[model samples]
Target: MSIKILTILTLLVPTLSAFSQEKMVSVNGVNYHVLTTSLEQRKPSQPVLVFENGMGMGLGNWNTITDSLANDAPVFLYDRQGVEKSEMVYQQPTPQKIAANLKLLLKELKIEPPYILVGHSMGGIYVRAFAGYYPNDIAGLVFVDPADFTETKADWNQIFRTIGVSEKQIDEMLIKRLYTPLKVDSSRYAAWSEGQVLTDLRKTDFAELSSLPIPQVPILFFVGGKLEVPMERRSKDYDHERFFEVKNSSNMLRWRRFIHASSKGGALIYLSNSGHFVHRDDAAIVIGNIRMMLKAMEK
Candidate 1:
C-alpha cells in the first residue's frame, strides 16, 4: 500500500475505535461502566437480553457471549459499582438497592420492556430479585449455577473447607490479587473483607420469592459439568457435581423441584464438556440454547 493510504487507514482505525468505547452512566450517585450492543437493531416488539456477571467478574468476560447474542437482538452488560472502571465505589449497598439501581439503569438507558435476563453465579440472585420486583417487564430468566439463600453459614464454610479454601486464604487472595492491582486503599479492602463478600452476596430473601406465585416466563438452567477444583484442594470424596451444585444435593434436586412446580416452560441442560464459564467453555451450547429460546419466542 502507498504511504499516504496506510497513514490514512491507521488514523481512521483509532478514530472509529474511540467512537465504540463503552459508556458510563450514573444512576442515584453510583457510577458504572455499561455496554449496550445493537440498540439500533433491536425490534420495538422484542425483548432485550441483559447479562449479569458472576461475583467479582466484570463485563469484560462477556465479549463472545454478548456478541453472539447481539447478532439477533440487543444485549446489555455493566460492571458492578466500585469495580473496574465504575469509579471505585466504597459504600456497600443492600440487595434491594442493587436491584433498584438495575431498574434505574434500564429506565435511563431506555431499553425496551420485556427483558430476557441472563445471570451467572451470584448474579443469578440479583436477576431473580429483578424478576420478582418487576415480573411484567421480564420475559425470560436464565440461571447459570446461581447462588442461593438456602446455603447456610455452616454450608458455606463446609463447602469451602471441603474444597480447601479457608476464610483467611480467601481474604488474603482478595487483598493480594484483586485489590492490589486496583491500588484500592487498605480501609476499603478492610470494609469489603469484613463481610467475606461471597457471604454477604448469599444473604437473599429467596423464601419469599419461592412462596410468591411463580412468574409466567421461560426459565433455563445450564449446569456446568467441568469444575476448577484442584485435585489437591478437594477432599477424598471429591466430585465435580458437588462443587458446581447450587444446593446441597449432587442431583440439584432443589432446582429440579422448582422447575417441576413452575407453570412456565423450563429446561435443564448439562454442559458435560464445559465448566463454570459456559460462554467460553462451550459457546455452542450457550448460543444454541439462546437461539432455541429466540425461536420459541417467535411463536
Candidate 2:
C-alpha cells in the first residue's frame, strides 16, 4: 500500500467511489431509487419518517442529519424521478402528481400511514400538499427553513447581485453548489424542463397549502433566524447595500404562518446560529424539537 501505488490506482479508476446501501423500488413499471435503513432499531409504535428533498438536492445532502436519526425510526429517502439515481420520466410534475407519486411509493413499499414528513426548502412545499391530500396518513411535520412565495426569485437574486454575482455566475453557482452535490447532471439544471418542474410545482404547492384548512396534526416549522452569507464572497463583491436581507424571508414569518396556526400547539423556532440547511447547521436543535413534538402528540 505504497503512496505511489495508491495514487496510481486513484488516477486509473476515477469512477471508483464508495456508495451507500440502497435499492430500486418499482411502482407500475417505473423504477425509483430508494435508500431505506434504520427500521431495525425503530420502536414498535414509532411513526415512519419520510424525507422529501429540496430542489436540486438528493439524499446525500441529508447524510449529516439522517445518519444520526436513521436508527431512531424507519427513515426513507428517494429521488423525485429523473433528478438523481431515479430515472427521469415526468416533465414539470404538478404538485398533485408529486403527492400521488409519493403516496404510491409508500403504498407499494408498505410504509403505511402516520408518517412524520420532514422537508427542506421547496421540499416543504410538496410536504404541505401531501399533508393536505392525506391528512389522515401524516402524524407530524418538520420543516427546515422552508421556502414559499413570500420570498421570490427577485428577492434572492437581489441578494446575489448585492453580493456582486452576475446572472450567469448565479446560474453556475446553482448548478455547482445546489444541484451537483445531489448527483444531478448539470445540463438538466440548465435546461428549461428541469427548472420549470420545481418552479411550477412551487406555485401550485403554495396555493394548495394556503387554501387548505388548518391541519390538526402536529407541525413544527424551523426558520434560520439570520442567514449567514459567505463573507469572503460578499466582501469581494460588496456593494455595501446588504448581503442577506433575509430576516423576513421564511414562510414562518409570513405567508405560511397558517401552518403555525394549524394547531394552538403548532410551533415555530428561529435558530439564530443556523442558515437555510437548519438540520445540517444544527441537528441537535432539529432533533430536540422533533422529540419535543412527538412528546406533545402523546397529550
Candidate 3:
C-alpha cells in the first residue's frame, strides 16, 4: 500500500472498535498523551498544526480553538511531561529534549510534517527549539502571550525565595493547584505531582536557550494587555509599565528581537482585553488571528 493509504488506515482503523480517544506515544523513555482531531473527516494534503499549552495547563486547554482550526488542517494537541496523561521520566525537560520527543512522536504516529506550531507561554520556548533544530519541518509559528524564560526565571526565583519555598516545592504546588482537577483521586495526584517536581529540577538555562539559531518560519506574536498585579499596586503610575517592561525584557521580547534580527517579514497582534489566559478570555479573537496567519502563510 502507498504510505498515504497506510497512514489513513492506521488512524481510522483504531477508532472503529471504540470512539477514537487519547493515544500515548513513548519516545526516549517518556510517554506523551496526544489528543487529535481532523475536520476533513478524511486526511487532507495540508500540513498538520500542533498546539502546545502553557505552563500548568494541559491538552484539554485547546479544546475551544482546535475544532475551528481542524476544519482547515489536522490539529494535534498533547500534554507535556507530567502535565496530563504524559509520563515523566528522570531525564531533564529542556527545550531541545522536548522538541526531540515531539519529533519522535510525530514520526511514530506517521503524521507527515511541515508543522505550523501554535504555542502559548512557555510552550513557545519548546516551539522555538523545535524550529531551531528542525527548521525545514516547520511551516509557521504562532506565539500567544508566550513566557520569557530569562525574565521568568529571575522573577520566579525571587517569588519562591520570598515565600521560603524551594523551587521543587514551588513547582509541585503550582502543578497541583493549576492542573490537577479537584475530583482526581489523591493517589493519582500524588504521583502526578511528584513527577512534575522532578521535571522542574531538570530545567535548562535561558542563556543556552537564547543562543540557538533562529528559524526562518513565518511567525506571529499575540500579547495580552491585562496584567496580573496586586490591587494595591495598580494605583502606582509605573506599575503597568513595569509589568510590561519586565515581560518585554524576557524571551518573548527576545523572540521579537529575533524577528527584527532577521530580514524576513512577520506579524504581531495585541489582545488588549485579555490576560495571561488569552485563549480562555477570548477564543474567537485568538482563533481568528490563527486563521489569518494560516492564510498569510499560504502566500
- Report the Cα RMSD per candidate: 9.1, 10.5, 8.2
Question: Which rank order by TM-score, best down to worst?
Answer: 1, 2, 3
lDDT for residue 234 in candidate 2, whole number 0-100: 52
- In candidate 3, stretches whose alpha carbon ends up further than 4 angstroms from where it belongs are 1-21, 39-45, 149-205, 230-241, 244-255
Worst 10 residues of 3 by lDDT: 1-10
Per-residue lDDT tens digits of candidate 3, residues 1-299?
Answer: 11111111124423222222357666665667776766235344466788877765788887777767776667778888777667655444667777877887787777777888988877876777787788788777888887653343445444444545567766775566445644433445523443353344324435655676666766778777777666776634234455454544453555666666545547766677888778778899888877876776566
User: Model 2, range 1-299, lDDT digits (tens) per residue?
Assistant: 11110011111211122223376766655667777665444565678778988876777778777765654566788787666766667455555777888988888666787788999977787787787788888888877777653444454555676556789976765455334434444366523343564554343434555575555777788887665655554545334325445434434456356554656456778787787888888888888777776666556
- lDDT, model 3, position 78: 82
Residue-pair clashes per candidate, as listed? Answer: 1, 1, 1
Candidate 1, residue 220: Cα displacement in angstroms equals 0.3
Each prediction's whole-model lDDT (CA): 0.65, 0.66, 0.65
lDDT of 2: 0.66
Error of 2 at 78 (Å): 1.2
Candidate 1 stretches with Cα past 4 Å from truth are 1-21, 149-213, 236-251
**lDDT value for candidate 1?**
0.65
lDDT for model 3: 0.65
